[model samples]
Target: MTLHCLPSTDITELPATVSNSTENPETQTTAPAEKSAWKTLSGLLPFMAPYRGRVILAGSALLVAAAATLTIPTAFRFLIDRGFSLPANVATDASASATAMADSGIAAGQVNSVFLGLFAVALILALATALRYYCVSWLGDRITADLRQAVYSQVLRQDPVFFETLRTGEVQSRLSSDTTLIQSLIGSSISLGLRNSLLFVGALGLMIWTSPHLASIIVGLLVLVVVPIMVFGRRVRKLSKDSQDKLADTGALANETLNAMSTVQSYVRENMESDRYSQATNAAFDSAIRRNRNRSYLTALAITLIFGIIVFVLWLGAQAVIDGRMSPGLLTQFMLYAALVAGSTGALAEVLGDVQRAAGATERLLELLHAQPAIASGKQSLVASSTADVAGLGARVDFNNVNFSYPSRPGEQALEELSFTIEPGQTVALVGPSGAGKTTVLQLLLRFYDPRSGSISLDNSAIDSLKLNELREAIGFVSQDSVVFSDDVYANLRYGKPDATDEEVRQAASDAQALDFIERLPDGFNTYLGEKGVRLSGGQRQRLSIARALLKNPPLLLLDEATSALDAESERKVQMALERAMSGRTTLVIAHRLATIVNADRILVMDEGRIIESGNHQELLAGNGLYAKLASMQFNAAEFHPAVEAVRVANSPC
Candidate 1:
């Protein structure tokens, strides 16, 4: 079980195959028309190359087993002709047969030796077959594991743009069901194909040696059998690819529905989802049936033609025996070899279908494994600057005349002429309505997507010139929708800082005001969070996310509606903690709640992907611009007391 990784890729050039499949899976599920199904399997050679030693051993075992099998008919010929061919006229009665054998000078020892020889051949065949199975099965398991890991690693490295066209469920389907098909091809089909191929060739050669006339006739018929098999095989391969795509559709649907179970249940659309899933499953079933039907037809034709040839050849050989043109033992040997030939040929046909099906699976896996992201990272790493080395203030972000649109929506600019600088240790807030590009600003700053035009720099160096890991490491991001994995509380908090000490974790949680609830859990910090932290309240999940980002303690922090889920008291406590953390770090806050950023060093009000005003809280209100309008909507003059500093806002801004 040799291990291997996929070849290193730039992660910037999106493969055309993947892009096509991602955009329209139904039409593009099949590989390119030019690539034959069999050729597609060749893509898996790299994955198999590492285990060539195991493969060689398996092949050797297969050859030995096949040879041992072919020897059995010859052993039978000796047993029948020498040991069992007692005087034909005296064989009706046991005493007569015994007398005839004695008169004919036939030895019992000879018969015993022939039987023992046959038994020895059988034993050898069984042992070799077992060894072959183990080696091939081991290769299958090991290679499949490596291939899956490599594909997953490649997917993980892709940027957001890559995922814009590919669905999570589709990716999951390729990872699981598609890989299973490859495993079957490697473990059983290829081995079976090879062994039977050897048997077929060996049997055909012996048949020709025994009776060239009969062998020639059979060879011509086998050629006829092959033409139809090849024709039907092409159809089966096409249908097989379609079947896999439909199955993937069902998986994608099921995954989407289950992941959004809450939404579906709230809408009382359980039956609707069930119907949709049933439709997808039915489509998959129809596709599978069509593929299998074509395969069955192929099998029927091959078996009929192959065995018909065997029966015809046997008839001819039997006639030869009656005419004394051939001995009874020789005819019997020919018949046995004929059966092997027919059986092996039929098995090869079956294996061909399996190989074709697996080829489709291989093509899909290769597409994903080879796909590249559009965003390329440079070899350069961010340098630790003198100002940034001061624990929390070294990082600086600059977006100069940056304009961008998401790949999925190229016509709509997500950000336009976005230019801003967050100086080291400065706190800046971006306040805007929904779709005003507040979050897009954070995304650009994080380099999730490159701007369509202009440049983004970190610490005076173009971000594209810095390695992704280094650039991302310098910034901590807390999105509005907090993500918490299904793990223990301590592990979730430690996600951003894998090497964080226990003390550091506890303190970060404490700063985020999550420690009290964490302590109240049944297992305290060790409590399981459940999927997406379903075990906790929305606010609690948000706090855990904040704690995670805090644990990283990056020089720059971006918070997008970080405290939107928290209650007032929890929000106040967390905000105070954030202010303290921001005291010496560059912080960019995206908040709809104006009150949250009232004390920020600077505020940028944005609309339609461009900043409309820039000022502090009082200055924005005086400008009576978008920011002032938002403030007035959230805070009423009659109910609001500036001194008390009380405010109210919608959960989601328009």
Candidate 2:
């Protein structure tokens, strides 16, 4: 059975100070601190500004629809009073019986005409409502697309430090779920609020006109519904935002675990991880339930209080009808208006809560967009010439009194006052135990982070003085992990030199000894490599990494434990390919296997972030220092690998 254990989590040092004063000026950039999102709604101005014309058109249609809805009550009033029922005085007049038949016929015709008029009003309402929906929905979709693009664009520019705090999955959650909430507020809630506000105002006006005494009672009771909703809606918004945060945590966990499924399953922590995810989801559910409960109370209050008040007022209107104080038609018309006012009031209560939730969501997305990278552009005049010209132009590298610690492991220096130099076309090896800071040296040269003190230079020019891309362009790297994306071989190789032609890519593969296996695959160079290149052997994967770097053909090459994971046979082949890759390049090898780098032009033995010994294979072996001890312990007589004739070295005892 394969053994699996959790990697070390214990930190031997505290985090680096937030101050940038000690950081090397050439690579240092500053980002503002995270601020609270109190003005988040105002942050959406740019995305909303582009759709102003559509917003205006949508508003106009909403108003027209509300007007049509309000007109329906007037049509009903005429049908009740003139078309169906005549005034009592008219029926009781002297010539009433003879004129009654004529009046009845006229009323019948008027009733049909009024029904047709109501139908026309409904048609207008439908058309206006549809147009309003189309316009607002389009605007919402367009705005969300632009907002996602803007957030991702900013996120892509951030340096490693930014990712150290926040995760990719959390960003994805805000991009999707948070933006979706904003879309709902824009497309549905805002339009509903405006239309219902107009309906409430117009209907209330007519209710007071028809019966001021009744309207006064209803208005006073509605204040009860409005006040509680205002109080409870604020709580609901807060609860909803908390729920979203908890859900985002669950998403982040899932994303992290899923990407490392091999590790998770290999260790059999499936249930443990599942339980953790369950706990997170349950917490989210609890928060959502609290928010939903508040909304439920608000809904119950609005509907019950307003409708109960309407029923009581309708009872008064019935009494007035029986007392001959008002006509049946007027009482009916008053009830309709009262109902319209109640419905509008109920809608406003719900819309308020939606507005609050959208506000919180908008704050989150705006926070993402506001994040600035710590690697902002530094002006420079340096340019990398063609790869051919760059060989002799500027391949020399130097480290001057450099000291560094990872931001996360601040007190433990990965490198301390380490100074070294490499001439063009020299092969140097860095051999040491694990955690001896071999990889850290390569990281510094790429300018992923700046040294805490001192400086690094390339070709006698400060590296930080050149643009980051320009500096990186001069070097090619192949690490032990050999990252292989889920893509075709052609695309993977082209990642090194994006515009390289097919012939160039194939030639690079041939140089790395990857062409034989690649061509043997079903689709040859077009074959799809599974995620992390699981379809290929370790040697094949390493060679592909070498091929990618070879395609770049930079003047400097870095091979960090490049063949450490392969079998003896695979190692021999990859080592050969690496030798071919190192031709005419300044090569730096960080390796654990003693045999791999024994023939280097020079070898440096690092321990505790400082070099204890440096020399060629024969000199180091004869010097009898840490290098000699490690070499004696690791091999019988470490001249070279016996599979193929090893490179001629300064001294070979064998």
**On residues 1-654, what C-alpha lDDT tens digit does candidate 2 reach at each position?**
001011111111111011001112222223334323334566777888977899889989888887888777667776676665754557566577437636566545666778888888878888888888889888878887898899889878777777776777777777877877777777776777777788889889999998999889888877776777667776767666666766777777888899999899999999999999999778777877787787777767777887899999999999999999987788888987887877777776677667666776776666668777655444453454233335453277788988999887898999988988887778899998888888989988887778899898777678777877777887899999888889999999999999999999999999887899999999999999998899998878988998999999888888899886677787777778778777677889998886788768889889988888899888888899988878766665544456323433324566
The Cα error of candidate 1 at residue 154, in Å, is 1.1
Q: After superposition, how far is residue 400 of candidate 2 from its true place, in Å?
A: 2.4
lDDT assessment of candidate 1:
0.81
Clashing pairs in 2: none
Model 1 weakest lDDT span, ten residues long: 2-11
For 426-507, candidate 1 gives per-residue lDDT tens digits of 8999998899999988888788888899998888888888888888888899999999999999899889999999999999
Off by over 4 Å in 1: 1-34, 86-106, 384-387, 390-392, 637-654
Worst 10 residues of 2 by lDDT: 13-22
- Pairs that collide, model 1: 12-373, 388-394
